[model samples]
Target: MKRQGGFTLIELVVVIVILGILAVTAAPRFLNLQDDARNSALDGLKGAIAGASGITYGKAAIDGVESLENQTISAGNETINIDFGYPADLAALEAVVDGLEADWSNAASGAAILFGYDGYNQRCVSYTPATGANVPAVTEVIEGCGTNF
Candidate 1:
């Protein structure tokens, strides 16, 4: 009698069971990565908005543009609308950042806009124009971002 060069049926079954268990344990971690990625992207957008606001404000000051509603100033190659020497609205913030795509909604008071990414339904970046001597504010909301993806 010759022994076959193959796994026994019991051994194969055990191997499959182990693989199934591993997959069951690992699946959730992999599934959650998409949400993590979306959160990270939103964080990056927040940083970009803050940086753009600062740079645009500096440029407006250097060019002697008065800090007033509806005034526009050149920042790098893009024009940023100003509200008291800060980014005026969502459009101005989008202009400063350039090439960023998101859904925008006006805030209740119309003093800010909420920019949300398509896949990240709950996550948003809020852009609030400066009031009085205060600088513009950019806030990121990652906690309420839906995990539909």
Candidate 2:
């Protein structure tokens, strides 16, 4: 009888079965990365919004435009709309933050920007500016917008 040098059929079948099992168990873990990335992006955007507001307010204060409404300031070539020394609208926020490619919708008080990921629109950040102050309230809408990720 001749000796075989390759893997036997039983051995190959067992190997394939183990690989299938591993894939079945691990696939879901990797699939959720899109949602995680979206969440991270939202956090970063929130921070950016806060930082931009502060910087713009600082510039407005320096230029003596804190009491001026609808004033525009040039922040690194981007024009930011100022209202009482704070960011006024989505356009102003986007101008200071830059590179935000999410879809925006006008809210009752301010604006909401929606970022889609993992086939859901669950990530939303809302900006609502106060009437008499330079502080804008930012809210992260994790529920009621779409499926929570």
Alpha-carbon local distance difference test for all models: 0.69, 0.66
TM-score of 2: 0.63
Question: Which candidate gets the maximum TM-score versus the true structure?
Answer: 1
lDDT of 1 by residue, 24-139 (tens): 99999999997788677767878887887788878877877645667889756777778777788766777877555443333322565666555556676667778754555555
Task: Give me the runs in candidate 1 sitting further than 4 Å from their true place.
Answer: 1-6, 64-71, 76-79, 101-110, 145-149
Task: Name the top lDDT candidate.
Answer: 1
What pairs collide in candidate 1?
none
Error of 1 at 100 (Å): 3.1
Work out how many backbone clashes candidate 1 has: 0
- Per candidate, the number of residue pairs that clash is 0, 0
Candidate 2 structure quality by residue, lDDT tens digits, 1-149 = 99889999999999999999999999999999977876776677667767777788889889888777778887776777888888787677667766754543333322544433435556655556534554554545444455332
lDDT comparing candidate 2 with the true structure: 0.66
Please report how far candidate 2 places residue 79 from its true position, in Å: 6.2
Worst 10 residues of 1 by lDDT: 101-110
